[model samples]
Target: MELKKILCAVDLMDTVNPAVEYAKMLADMSGASVSVIYVISSRSTYENLQVPVEEIAKGMRRIWSRSREDMDAFVAAYFPGVDATGFIYEGKPAEKIVEIAREQDVDMIVMGTHAREGLDRLFFGSVANEVVKSSKCPVMTIRPEKKSE
Candidate 1:
């Protein structure tokens, strides 16, 4: 299928580069535009009850601002001189990703897989797995390269 636009979901972590590079390669090959998205999960916004609501909100704002800067740097690093738009959304990560993909009408969704297992996977669940299952469009997941000993 011809890809006019591609949606890339990143967490602005170590996994981001591989996913962004893969998406960039695909976009270059297919002559498609790329849109990068970072989701801030609602659960991440919660803190100690004694912190106070105002403090929580202020902390969230700081987090958002820092995240935005990181996102900008990420795109610049991976997609220099390319016309890629970056987006930030707040909610459950996988759900927001799928929703944005559908809303944007992208041809494919690109994301990174952390390859969690056992208890960790069971407790936290896999965002990539959820996105793959729920996304209306095709999902391409790039696993981070194994680090050498």
Candidate 2:
């Protein structure tokens, strides 16, 4: 397939390099541009909280600023010398990931999965699973290698 753009979804909470490496490899082979998206899942929680408007605004700003920094750092570390766009969105992570993939009209979506099964999957709610089901483009999920304890 002729790939012009790739969407890389990162949680910034787990091991993010592995998935990014796959995306970068694909992009290198297909000459595609990469867009990294980090979705903030705490927006709804903040909105539902009984907090002052000013406090909520401050909280939101803090989250946005920190997310931006993290996203930039991730891109720089994983995609050095590559032109990658980093984006931050607020809302449900799975929903945002699918939405951005559609909006960007990406050729492929790459992400990392915890590979949770059974009760763990149900309790954690796999973002990779949701994106795979919801995205129109091809989805590639990478499960990080287990760290040696």
Highest-scoring model, lDDT: 2
**What local lDDT does model 2 show for residue 50?**
80
lDDT of each: 0.83, 0.84
Q: Taking the tens digit of each residue's C-alpha lDDT, what string does model 1 give over 1-149?
A: 89999998887755434588888988888889899999986734486456778887888898799999998888888887666888888898999999999999999999888766689779978889999999888999988786211
> Model 2 reaches what TM-score against the true structure?
0.88
Give stretches of model 1 more than 4 Å off. Answer: 43-50, 147-149
Task: Write down the TM-score of every candidate.
Answer: 0.89, 0.88
lDDT of 2 by residue, 27-139 (tens): 88888899999888765677677888789889889888988898889898889866689999888889889999998889999998876678977997888899999889999
Q: How far is candidate 1 from the true structure (C-alpha RMSD, Å)?
A: 2.5
lDDT of 2 at 84: 88
Candidate 2 backbone collisions, by pair: none
